[model samples]
Target: MGVCLVLIVLAWNVVRLWSTTAAVVMSVVAAVLPPIAAVVANWGEDH
Candidate 1:
């Protein structure tokens, strides 16, 4: 996520009008949720 943000910032700096904000947002969500989902799935498997 930090890398994505850095890329976005670099692109914005280079192009000054890049439209990858959604990609950055999606990358952040994609970074955070899957492991949480996996843990929830594992916990539920025992119950």
Candidate 2:
């Protein structure tokens, strides 16, 4: 997802310099988002 990619890029480039822990947290959250989006997107689908 676009949001996930943005978070990762920002975490790597910007956040990491400020705090590696925070960047790792952001990356973890970003990693979780796409699967959540997929589940939500298909939540009520017939197939």
What clash count goes with each model?
0, 0
Q: Write the per-residue lDDT of candidate 1 for residues 1-47, one digit (tens) a residue.
A: 45556655565565445556755665566566667777877996765
Which segments of model 2 are wrong by more than 4 Å? none
What tens-digit string does per-residue lDDT give for candidate 2 at 1-47?
Answer: 88999999999999999999999999999999989989999999986
TM-score of each: 0.41, 0.88
Residue 31 lDDT in candidate 2: 94
